[model samples]
Target: MSLSVVICCYTAARRVQLIRGVQSALEQAGDRDEILVVVDHNDALLADLRDSLPHQITLITNEFQRGLSGARNTGVARSRGDVVVFVDDDAVLATGALDGARAAFEDPTVVAIGGAVRAEWAVGSGPSWFPEEFGWVIGCDYRGLPACGERIRNPIGAAMAARRQALVEIEGFSTELGRVGDLLAGCEETLMGVQLQSRFPGQRIIRHTDFRVDHHVPADRATLRYFTRRCYQEGRSKAVLTRISGRQAALSSERSYTTSVLPSGAWRARRNPRRLLALVIGFGYTTAGYVTGLLLSTRSAAAA
Candidate 1:
């Protein structure tokens, strides 16, 4: 299957990372593959990239809403490949990543595929207090994901792909649920996976460990404050997803993560006071956010 990589960017602050991401995609693209750089309503960044990027790369401004989901939707619409892969602007595709995705899609039963996202910290390694189980807060592959090739409820947004038809059937990513400007809200991918499964019953969404990407984790995201805020936002996103897609479908993976994965992680971190404390604090914040979001959503429904 021909691949179309959609790298979305919204700011000039990540100009360096975005360029590297595009370059990585370009290097790994097959003869039939294409790379599209979607700038989320940023005119200045669009103009700058147009001049700096290679001619083969297609750079365009987001013609939909002003956020990550909209930018991704715009890319999906413009792309011509059989598989539309979404790569974050701050992430670099590993060698053969596109090939891996195409190979997996050879199975007609698969509709979506996601790969590992290794963290490339801005400082030495990463914060010692950061727990591995909560790596999703930084868009990295966390501890407790299935061994690979196993089915997943959803693919992480930073490095995921969907069959073009599957995406078109679902009408692309929902604009309601993703990062808008500075808001950390997300779960667009989660909703997409649910929609895909509903639309094509029996189809699979699996993770391919070989199809990997290295995501740049800036210093700002390494802080405790950012960690808490991100965890809370994740909870809020999950609540929104549950409201839209029903709780059973929305929180299936989360239930397992909470009951099985987290307990194991906590036990492993018991020897490290800092990691153990971080895990506990992160869980508390996420739970608080989920409750707050659920209450707000319920109130809004009644008010409506």
Candidate 2:
């Protein structure tokens, strides 16, 4: 099966992190259908990459729009492969990850695969106040995920691979949904997965936890303010997602996460006083964000 790996970058600030991503791709590279570096409306970054990237790797300027979704869509357009894998510019893949993707796509029913991501803390350890249950804040596959390869609702953008045909059929990632420049908003991945499922019922969007990557979480993200803001932004993003993809099913997992997961995590943290407080604050902030976002969304709908 032919494979195309796409990496998206938006700034020169991430140049060091981007180098690590490039090296990982090089190590995993073979006869790729193509390896594209999609620069998202950043001419300066694009120019710098022109002097930096190896000649074998294809460079793409995202003319589609100015977000991660658009950059990814541009990459998909330039790619000629049965399967397209999107990797984050800040992540490094595990050995044989690409090979595993090629093998997984051999099954025609497997439309997409989300590999696990292990957090690599910039300070070399997780912050005490940063609850592991909220790991999704950094785009890492947080806890409560399935322990093995199985049908998953969505693929985390850090390392998600999908069939070329499925992405085309669904019209690729939504420009309204994902990260644009500095925004932490997501749910574009969720929207794409929902579309894929709608079009090809019973098709598998598998989560293979063993196909892993090291995702760097900067120390700045360890702050309570950052975590809370990210959670708030996620709530807003999900509101938009629910609007675009229907409410009940789009929020099924959110209900589970709120009603079940956080409560269990709070119980587990009972022994640790700080952790207990962290869990409570985390849940409170996130729920508040979701409600506020929902209200704003309702107002927007009424106006429309």
Candidate 3:
């Protein structure tokens, strides 16, 4: 029942905070636990980072740079815990999060459990009129309330844990989808979620309100350009997910005419039509990306 905390570190910018996250996890872990920080590349900070923690923090550096997905896979390979808890280098777990997660995964059917991700700077982040279904910009309850339940989709990568065996069975995260260099896009986690659901239909992918993590959204992500880019990427990823799964059912057509775009589209539209316009542009971009990805795949296959 030991827990393996896997923090995939690309650079040392987040080394300190991630160490704190590791320490927090160690404190909360009732069973035997070890922290495996997978460093994708070697840097001057490596020496200092190595000396900064207890022997429990095992640092595994790659000979060549592997991206986030690769680093995670590396960590998973080197870990010894039955449950592999993954937290982004920039995220810190809330008190008792690991304990709650342990209980959540006790059900044999449950393969994974994701913690509630609350923005550390939620005070002035955005208008409350945002949609909950949108995964690009995730923000849990602002005032620290226990908002727990079954999730319709995948949980944020900020804080989630899975049985090591299940992750191995699924082959871990996807290298094709997540942010590696400057891609600024993501869908690997969502695609994994879809696969998990397909393989284990009765098993509930529970989001434990009791298990929470604080994600510090950089100020750069608060701008309009960033939000729009995120929306575009999300739309693109949606198309990719649908194409891979062959599951398309007029995603937004179910909602009432007024609120079909997003949860807060109607509210924003009442003030300015830009909200609806944004939705249209997002969908168009998504369709284009999806078609382009499919065509490219076909071309590559033909060449092969």
Candidate 4:
């Protein structure tokens, strides 16, 4: 299947990482594949990319709302590939990642595919106090994911691919729930996965460990404050998603992660007080955010 790799950027701060990500896609893209760089309402960044990025990449400013989801929707609208793959501006695709996505789509039963995302921390490695269970807070694949390729509820947004038809069928990612500027809200991809499965029953969203991307984790995200804030934001995003898609669809994976994965992780980290404490704190922050978000959503519904 032809793949269209979409790399979206919003700031000049990640100019180097964005360039590297585009170059990586250019290198690994197949003959039938195409690369698109969507700049989310950043005129200066768009101009810079136009001058520096290779001519092979199709560059365009986001024509939709001002967030990752809208930028992605813009890319999908302009793309011509069978599979639309999303690569974060701060991430580099591993060799053969696109190939793996193409191979997986060979099975008509699969509608979406996500790969492993390894962290490339700015200070060499994550802080010693950071627990692996909360890696999602930093936008990297965490410890709770299945060890091998399998059908999954959803794919991480940092590096995931979906059938263009399925995306079109679902009308693309929602503008309601995703990062708007520096806001930590997310779960646009999760909602998309639920919509895809619901619209096309029996189709699969597979997680392929072999197809991977190295996501850059900036130093700012390595702090304790950022960790707690992100966890809380994640909970808020989940609550918003649950309101839109219903709890069962929005939180099936979270149920397993909270009940089985987290408890297991906490138990395994018993010997390491720091790690255990981090996990506990992260869970608490997330839970608090979810509760607050739920109340807000309920109030909004009543007001409506």
Candidate 5:
């Protein structure tokens, strides 16, 4: 099966790293695979991409809205491959990654394949208090995730592949539940995962630990402030996901993380003063965000 790898880009500051990510996709892809770069309506950034190290790479503007979900929809609409893989603009794929995705599709029962994502830290290492259990803060696979191949509810957006026809059947990502420019809110992937299973009852969402990519984590993201903010945004996004997808299933994993994982991480941090302090502060921040998100969602519903 042919593969179409789509990378959505926005800022020019990521120019060098974004090109590296593109190169990684090219290297990992088989001869039948194609790469598409979808710029999120940043004209100057789009123009600069055209000028610098000019290649025949297919580039397009987001046709629908100006957001992550919109750009992804734009690329999927134009992609030619049977399976379309969404790779983060800052992530670099591992060797033979596309081949793995292509192989998963051979089963026919697998609608989507999620690859493992490891963090490539710009600062060499993360803070002592920032637990690995919360790796989702950096968009990396966390400690509690399945360590081997298994059926999953959703693949994190970093490097997930799906059948083109499947995406079309479910009508692509929801326009309401994803990042729009500066807004960090998102759940489009989570919402789509729900639709994917609903649309095809027998098909499964698979996560293969070996099919991998290194998602770049900038130095700024390693900070406690960023960690807190991300968890808060995650809480807000979770609320949105609950609204779109049923709350019971939408929060299954989250419940596990909150009750079992976070508490365990907190207990583990008690030995270190820095870690303990961070745990207390981060927990409070996330709780506040969750409450605020729920309140706003309720208000919005009432107004509607």
Candidate 6:
């Protein structure tokens, strides 16, 4: 099947190191496959990317810089493929990954497939090991080894593929679930999955353990400050989404709530000779940030 790869990027100078990871995908993709780079108001970086890549890569400069969701929609509208793959500009796909993903889609019941993600810098970037205090918090090591028969709630947006028809029926990603500026709001992928499952029951959204991607977690994201901001954004956006999408959106909110309190559970393990204290601290901060963010979101909605 033909594949269309969509990558959304902004001003990513310091994170250029991640580009090498994306380049690795070229090795796996066929020459006829397409790469659409969506640049959200980053002209300089767009120029650099255009010059660096081959002519097969299509570059679209978002005139209004309408955030990640809007950019993805733009790319999807312009692309032509039986299957559409969304790869984070900063993530690199593993060798032979796409071939396996294509195989999984052969099952008519499988609507979407998520490739597992590994930390590119589990040692050098965050802490030498997973942070004990925040290990259970969002953005931590993904424990994706669910039983082969189990279905996942959501697919990580970084490395997901879906039938183009399903995406069209859903009308693309939601603007409410992605980040606003530097904030780290999430759950757009989960929201999309909800719609997919409801529209096509008995159709599974499987997680391909072997189809992997290396997510280059920037050093900034590893810092306490960045994580706190991410937690806050996630909390606030979730609350806002509930208002916009109704009670069903609360499912996403629950995930945000778990992100808030999970650190303490990890903390409890820390005292039992688990040395996961850092992860605990990360989760604590995440909870605090989510609470703060929810309040801010409520106030902002009232004002608007």
| Residue 270 CA displacement from its true place in model 5, Å | 3.1
Which lDDT value does model 5 have at 37? 95
Comparing candidate 2 with candidate 4, which one achieves the higher TM-score? Answer: 4
Candidate 2 C-alpha lDDT tens digits along 1-304: 8888899999888788888988888888777467899999988999999999999889989979899999999999999988898989999988988887777778878889998888888988887766778888888977777666788888888999999988999999998889888888889999998889899897888997656788888888778888878887887888788878888757867778888888888888888888778778777776677788789988988999
Worst 10 residues of 6 by lDDT: 132-141
The parts of candidate 1 lying over 4 Å away from their true place are: none
Put down candidate 5 lDDT per residue, 177-249, tens digits, no spaces.
8888766676788888889989998999989766688999998898887888877887788777777777886
What is the lDDT, from 0 to 100, of the residue 291 in candidate 4? Answer: 90
Provide TM-scores for the models: 0.98, 0.96, 0.80, 0.98, 0.95, 0.83
Best by lDDT: 1
* Collision pairs in model 5: none
Give the lDDT ranking, best first: 1, 4, 2, 5, 6, 3
Candidate 3's displacement at residue 165, Å, is 0.8
Q: What is the lDDT of candidate 4?
A: 0.91
Error of 6 at 69 (Å): 0.8
**Candidate 3: which stretches are off by over 4 Å?**
62-65, 122-124, 127-135, 138-147, 239-243, 248-265, 272-288, 291-295, 298-304
Please identify which of the two predictions, 5 or 6, would achieve the higher TM-score against the true structure: 5
The lDDT values for all models are: 0.92, 0.85, 0.66, 0.91, 0.84, 0.68
> What lDDT is reached at residue 185 by model 1?
89
As a whole number from 0 to 100, the lDDT of residue 172 in candidate 1 is: 97
Local lDDT at 101 for model 5: 78
Roughly what TM-score does model 6 have, to 2 decimal places?
0.83
Candidate 5, residue 87: Cα displacement in angstroms equals 0.7
